[model samples]
Target: MRAFDLAASAKAAAQAAVDAAAPDLVALSHRLHAHPELGFAEERACGWLGEQLTEHGFTVTAGVGELPTAFVAERGEGPLVLGICAEYDALPGIGHACGHNVIASAAVTAALALGAVADDLGVTVRVLGTPAEENGGGKVLMLERGVFAGVHAAMMVHPSPRERLDPTCLARAQLHVEYDGRAAHASACPEDGVNAADALTVAQVAIGLLRQHMTPDQRVHGITTTGGQVPNVIPEHTEADYYVRAATLAGVTDLEERVRDCFRAGAVATRSRLTLSSTSPAYSEFRHDPGLLAAYERNALVAGREFPTVTAEDDRQAGSTDMANVSLAIPSIQPLVSIDSGDVGLHQAEFAAYAARPAADRALLEGGLAMAWTCVDAALDEGLRARLLAGATAGG
Candidate 1:
């Protein structure tokens, strides 16, 4: 049958296309790792990725979605539109600690592989150069700006310590909590001064005690950015940033309210002014499409990648991602591709050092091929295509 032939041809071509581009993809990952850029400032990473897409006959658009570093490269005019996300942001000090270089290169390769068969499959392939995942929420902004309005389904693989079919990500909200008070000479006019540092200290202590009653899926962590200029004078101003995460967006709201109350208690006890605000939109919890996830698992297994059995403990340790916001808008999946960083967790120097290692390079090819095959499978399957289109229509 023509359908069987197209499926077999697409599967083989996807693997072959990624294999042919393996060297350049690995080199691109290394280049991105070597020159790490912060979120929304990934000029070089965005330009390099766009260059590759342009060379591959894609119409590249930089500075899309009102974000300068955000770009999208597109090809084909068919019915199905597949959005492949490429994240290239690095952490402040740990540079590439999350292996975004691996993510960017693999996503591009996957798009290129799909481009090879787009005409035969009557599909349109797109590679979205999403610029921020670490410090800025680029994807969230793009989602708000209608950048992904017409996208049917999205897929991007994250590099991690171990492979996962689909990750369990927590919803997170960023917060800024500050206190203001009067300052005076510590010894001479202690009664005239209201110690802002004391307010923060009280808040921290309250949070420490609050841990006792924390639910299994609730998490709150913060760092004091300012305490005092010197210990001799009473501190007048103090500020802190915190991230509140929970199993769902509603849970994030509930946890944030309780956490704010702890900080408010500090301000009340010290007679200091309380200021609280959210730094960005809360990143939502992810919901993976079952059809796409199943297709990805099959492709990954055939490409010599195996996933460890997922457990609740794994969910407890899962990190939050802005891709979760994109999932809320469209059918999306962010699968984890393993790197050989034993005992070295993400956002650490050790993990950054191994991001471009041999194992990581291997992961780049496997992940790209697996994703490309997944898309191919989806295109070739009638029921799956209809389901994704129906979802897109409803999402619209």
Candidate 2:
């Protein structure tokens, strides 16, 4: 009996498959970029990715984990289940500023390519349509609901202005804070008004002051979703949403406790009712599997992707991702695939425009091939395969 050399022939096949699917993958990326959808509302993106998988002979289950946009697409019957995380949710107003369209496209291409050789490698390929990485923790919710039940190895590539392996990501939690007060005419009887706006002001000031006490890695930021209707009417109710980020989940937990004190201070100072609650489940920090990370670097290099020699201090990735939560339960890696976005930062409108450019399209193809090759490499390596097989199943 002769064993196939997955590192040699299988590599070429995977790359070829990605090349063959380049046109459709590019179209998918562009379509997602053109029609932006917010977190948990990625109907178009979800339907499109799922349809592509279904057309290519994958068994796709939509609306998994109680999320309308979440889906799981699988092929092959091998014991080793490889999970590909596809994030397609866009920012609130900036569209696909974080280039999740590229992420989704890459995941689909990787899954398709891997599916072609899954049997030979004795592996199962699963592409997960994970939504709402922008603001909500859709993956977190899905994980809690048992969506990622049988995945052995999970992998995804995020788009960024620069390429890097094992990039640092923060753990964060979202907070919804509100203040309720009595309303009165501002000009006529200002003294009688228990101003909700003032309460929010006190909270904002407290938050600013609290920042001084926090570590450099700790961050707290928010926006007033509803401040008031008019200046004449003293604000009866004020609401805001904030994000508290830290280097780790424990740090985020500690910071949230401190931050809530600031919110409570507003109510105490203004004699108003304070309502503060978590908007979504907390996102954990990224934990990269060293084996998967090395495989991806090698494959990315073969795909002509280069790591940056110099990166700006401020340009480093610091935002939270729901994919990080997947790492907690599965052996995973969520590396950044660099695109030529110039100096524009992610979550900015200009970055969203760059997400649809030719460079980003190239990233979609190359990142897919790299990830597919990595999966093949992992499946072929005896040690890596054994390790992955021994791990608990996350999604299949």
| Distance from true location, Cα of 310 in model 1, Å | 2.5
Off by over 4 Å in 2: 1-4, 310-317, 392-396
- Superposed model 1: Cα runs more than 4 Å off: 392-396
lDDT of 2 by residue, 178-285 (tens): 899999999999888898888989988998999888987798998999999998999999999999999999999999998899888999999999988887899998
Local distance difference test, each candidate: 0.89, 0.89
Per residue, candidate 1 scores C-alpha lDDT tens digits across 29-139 of: 999999999998999999999998888889999999899999989988778888999999999888999999999999988988888789888889988888888766889
Clashes of 2: 6
C-alpha lDDT of residue 384 in model 2: 84
| Backbone-clash count (model 1) | 0
Positional deviation of residue 306's Cα in model 1 after best superposition, in angstroms: 1.4
